[model samples]
Target chain A: MSSEISSRGPADHDVRDQIVIAATEHFSLYGYSKTTVSDLAKAIGFSKAYIYKFFESKQAIGEMICANCLQDIETEIRTAVNEVDGPSEKLRRLFKASVTASLRLFSDDRKLYEIAASAATEQWQAARDYEVRIKALLQDILLEGRQSGDFERKTPIDETATAIYLVLRPYLNPLLLQHNFDHADEAPTHLSSLVLRSLSP
Target chain B: MSSEISSRGPADHDVRDQIVIAATEHFSLYGYSKTTVSDLAKAIGFSKAYIYKFFESKQAIGEMICANCLQDIETEIRTAVNEVDGPSEKLRRLFKASVTASLRLFSDDRKLYEIAASAATEQWQAARDYEVRIKALLQDILLEGRQSGDFERKTPIDETATAIYLVLRPYLNPLLLQHNFDHADEAPTHLSSLVLRSLSP
Candidate 1:
């Protein structure tokens, strides 16, 4: 099989989407590690070679699914933060929304969570990209807060953002979430409050 | 094999200590997961039944070793904090010292770190007890800071301590340390400063 998909046509895009959808369903039912490329091909009624034309490997497919899941969570967080008024409120909303979205994924689609957890634990590019995006969003909020005279400008934006990201890592990281699962709801609120206090001008 | 040692005499204590010392050396050399009870017994010149008299299982030996490692780290942190004058300084030292001690384990004793990581991931009683003790230490420091007028008393102490513990969890938990290893040195300084800023009266 070619290393590249080799097709950019609308039909090919549809086939790619179909493969992802079918693979996600198969992985959800059978678990990610247990499901093989052959199983995916059989479930999707495609030849193994045909599946290979659209994807390089099982992990390549998993990367796409993991990215999609993270994207959905990011969208939810952004929507929640945007719905709020001030930077402080937005930061609080961001924290609460992030925990809510993550816990939902953990409780609702645990099989998908296993894939994301592996992506995180293994340091997959998808997980790294997601981390960069989340940190960017945080820095954006910090910049906004500083400009609006809501947050203190004494601390460097990047360092402050990294610290906040580290604080939120336990809840967002699937491997660490089992220990923090019971505190998922209240911990965010408490942490955001502490963080907001530090951010106060 | 008997679950209990059945003897509280000094001889029994020495024998138990010898088993732990031998098991630790064996685990450190061959790694934890790869070593078994029979291997440990063979290396220690004890029968498998003799080894079981002192510990219930391989994991029990692992628990003792893990507890010893954590206890060593905690002693280092406490010493660093005690050497400082003010609560704020002690708090900062706590973070720095905790990170330093943990990173030392991660780098110098990685074989043992595997055991600690497993203990954390599996929610072992040793890990839980370690967490409780660490949080208690944080709470004690927070209380001192508040009483001495160095920290704000607006928030409840337990919640505040819990939040700070969560912030430090990534650096301390071996399971989560793989991602945060690069930042092990600087992140603690940045985070402790952020936490201290929030604590300021």
Candidate 2:
């Protein structure tokens, strides 16, 4: 989606898209905290006023970039889970894929990861929304497992889903993930298996 | 226990104790980030060189303070676990006590908690040592449970302890705890129960 342009005119959309692209490049190269709106305008050959027309603030642009990055991770997790059969296998794949995708971001695109970390520390809407979606996915998996007699139904689905989310929260939240990244490679297998064991009837 | 004084003379111990007390008072009053070595020196009626003689730097002082804070939480956790008879109950109490002690620090001593948060974020020796202690405690609980025919013996004790510690990491690490404090109350109960369920023989 284009940025803050109120109108749907093609030219307006083009300008918004160009600004986002330029900002992403600038942010990646110099890092998010060091780059300012003025630096972005200079790098993108746009006036400060023009950039502001599309973005309300530097954090606004960061929010958009962070949202896109989170979406990429979500997509990878979904694809991995989809290839597996049974709710148990799907949940296992989901945990592994989630950790792998996030770790890749941390190693491959560290600058972007910084933005996500900041977003999480600030409790930005994007970070909160990402958590909500992950919990919803967990609930869906738990419901599926219950229906198939793969998981126990004694624990309320909502509490079960929330608990599972909390277990995964450290690895999912970039701020916490960076600290625990060393153990992350083996964590998914161990954690998912343990959780699956708990879910058994 | 005193600062870097090589000799264990009573006067050296007194000066070190004075510096620590003054620094803690300053930190609690103005927050760790806002106060400086010079501020502590001034507050304690000591020369800046004298303060540095005791602590290599501001962070060195912070490390001691942070270590003390973590030890307080550890003591609380141990007392809570010891009050229980069974491994399951002990583990559950350990989880709850850890969260409660940390949350208390966050609420009652926000400034001190900031120092602990900084220590965790920086991965100071104090923070790492605290984690190692907690994991060791977890291993002990798991081993006890296994011995009593409570926890399953199928999973390796080391691996299971590590997994449980990871689950509890967010609630224990002050940097991450601040973000998840909203869920801290219910988390220990739900999480410990889930973990206990998995451990059942």
Candidate 3:
């Protein structure tokens, strides 16, 4: 653990990437609280000082792991949403894919889900940032729907977007989703239909 | 404080009511965690032993305060819902009154709102019971709407009611509502319309 891996400068950009990957693995496998800076260094044959050269502290590493999870979700949302044409179908696919992506991300790695849950309770920067992204995504869909006359809104775009986000809570929010796991298959389909029906002119 | 308010036996029913009233004042004024059993005992002119005779702990007293708040909200909702005729109007008033009643409760007593927030985070028994009571209330309204041909449902009564609960969350959930206090008057109006429109035949 005392041995440093890099012949390159400690501030090297590659080292930062390595630190995030190793930290993500540790967070997703053993759990967030249990993983130490020392363990992160050992995972990549670096010393604690070298790890600090990249991430300021364990908390920063935790932030990076949460950011990584949201990024993964965002990428899937974009792909699913872009795959379709028109606002109505795009809204349906995008909303459904967000739930599906999160389920897959958490179900495959329980520890990552635990990290997400912890982030939510602690009100971590990453968690709040994730919400902004989702709301923006919904806002775009609603705006497009309104412009194209495919849907009508009962409120302004921001409020309508927020209402849609809240309505899909049981299927989208990981904490609430945990309680409704029995309806894992049916929830997205049912809730999305309710949302679409609400928007239909 | 050592002087007993009554050797009439700690089981006197009025003693229990007196304790709850004093505790609510202290909790609303000083704060839940700050208000101790000793403080409560002092407030009610009773000994600590007398306080313990009624509530097992400070936590129990906190639970009672939260339960009292929910009961107040329920009374308002029942009165408003029952006063109106037609399921649409009943549902509209029921949802609106729930938000309005909660806003009034939390506004007049910020510390009590804090207690409710704490109870929610701690998932206290009293909090869970309050949710069950609300869901039942919503279920009754939804069923009535369905039977009266004022509403059509895409799901069972329970799920529809739960979805309604989730949808009204921004306006109804104490924690979220605290941030949106400026919309205090408008939230119920907008959200109620959303709820009614969703339920429309």
Candidate number of the best DockQ: 2
For model 1, the docking class works out as acceptable
Which predicted model would earn the best lDDT? 2
Off by over 4 Å in 1: A1-8, B1-8
Arranged by DockQ, best first: 2, 1, 3
Q: lDDT of each structure?
A: 0.87, 0.88, 0.76
Runs of candidate 3 exceeding 4 Å displacement: A1-11, A25-63, A75-129, A132-160, A169-190, B1-11, B26-60, B76-97, B103-111, B114-129, B136-150, B153-159, B169-191
For all candidates, state DockQ relative to the true structure: 0.45, 0.51, 0.12
Instruction: Please say which candidate is ahead in TM-score: 2 or 3.
Output: 2
Instruction: Give the interface RMSD of candidate 2.
Output: 1.3
Q: lDDT value for candidate 2? A: 0.88
TM-score of candidate 1 relative to the true fold: 0.88
- Lowest lDDT sum, 10 consecutive residues, model 1 chain A, at A1-10
lDDT of 2 by residue, A91-135 (tens): 999889989998988999888888998998898889889989888
- Sorted on TM-score, best first, the list reads 1, 2, 3
Instruction: Report how large a share of the reference interface contacts model 1 reproduces.
Output: 0.46
Report how far off residue B61 is in candidate 2 (Å).
3.9
